[model samples]
Target: MELVPFKDTGKAPAQNFTGDVYVTSIKTPTEPSRLTAALVRFTPGARTNWHSHALGQTLHVTEGVGYVGTRDGKVIRMRAGDTVWTPPGEEHWHGGTATTFMCHIAMLEASAEGDPTTWLEPVTDETYQSAGN
Candidate 1:
């Protein structure tokens, strides 16, 4: 057994996200564990760029309100204690609501080559604000 000390990774790059975002690596893949987990926090209106996981991803909301936007014009609102699952290879983005800060524990499995995610273009206002914007 071992303890993983807390570390602040700082603001997420604007190229990959919008607004203020921070992440704390929780657990990374190892020889015996392929699970990758992180604590992701977002300030009001902050969000991730479109991305997908090789083995899908699970998000367990821990604070505030947010929205999970999918490529098919779906924007699902989320709140603390709520959980959502994104299927493998499905393009999507998650973020805090316009008026609230939000945080979630994101979990996914590393791929065979240890690459777990593929990030794509940023979600545009036409697709992120709402189903049809």
Candidate 2:
């Protein structure tokens, strides 16, 4: 087995994120490997846009508190050591709570086209506020 080199941390694009978020690539698809993984950090009030994966996604929280929410209004409060899964094609968003920072390892499989995620519109302030503290 070969050790993977560390990748530089990068800001999650504003086009797909709200507030401040950082991502460090942990694993990227190589020949015969469709898996992709990253360590994502979110500042207070930071969050992802509504998006979905072709093969579902899993997140394991490493620090602080956060919320994982879906189109059906289901929301899960996640804390350190918590893990959550979103099934394929289910629109969802996740991020730090308003007063806490959150970090999680996100894992998913890439689609045949090499893109795993389809990002939709930004979650509005109203929608975010509704998520509660």
Candidate 3:
């Protein structure tokens, strides 16, 4: 029964993303828990680099349109209230579309020992355009 101190929204690190982005961490469970949550916002045409969670990740869209793409060439267009899940080790990237700001609550679980998130190369114009965005 303790309160977690809220922190100010911060700019997302370029090391983990491709363009301008920001995030505000909402919750990170203590030692006994393994969950982490954040409110992530992507500027128009901004997105994350291809990466995957060790356990998995879930995103609940809160506003604007979102574009999610996988290596399989599928791009999912999601809107407010839409939920998207990426299974463990699935390579994918997500962000705001060409003309809108997007926000989502992202949830992730800590991975077991010896298994961590794997980040891949940046998404290229070829791949991004392939998404039809």
- Pick by lDDT: which candidate is best? 2
**Off by more than 4 A, model 1:** 131-133
Error of 3 at 8 (Å): 1.6
Better of 1 and 3 by TM-score: 1
Q: Order of candidates by TM-score, top first?
A: 2, 1, 3
lDDT (tens digit, per residue) of candidate 1 on 1-133: 8787787687777889988999988888887789989899999878999999999999999999999988787778999999999999999999998789999999999988668889899877666566323
Q: Tell me the whole-model lDDT of each prediction, alpha carbons only.
A: 0.88, 0.95, 0.86
**Which clashing pairs does model 1 show?**
none
Give one digit per residue, the lDDT tens place, for model 3 in 1-133. Answer: 8888889999998987877899999987667778889999999878889999998899999999978998888899989999999999899999988788899999988765633467778888677666654
**List of clashing residue pairs for candidate 2:** none
Supply the global lDDT for candidate 1: 0.88
RMSD of each: 1.6, 0.9, 1.6
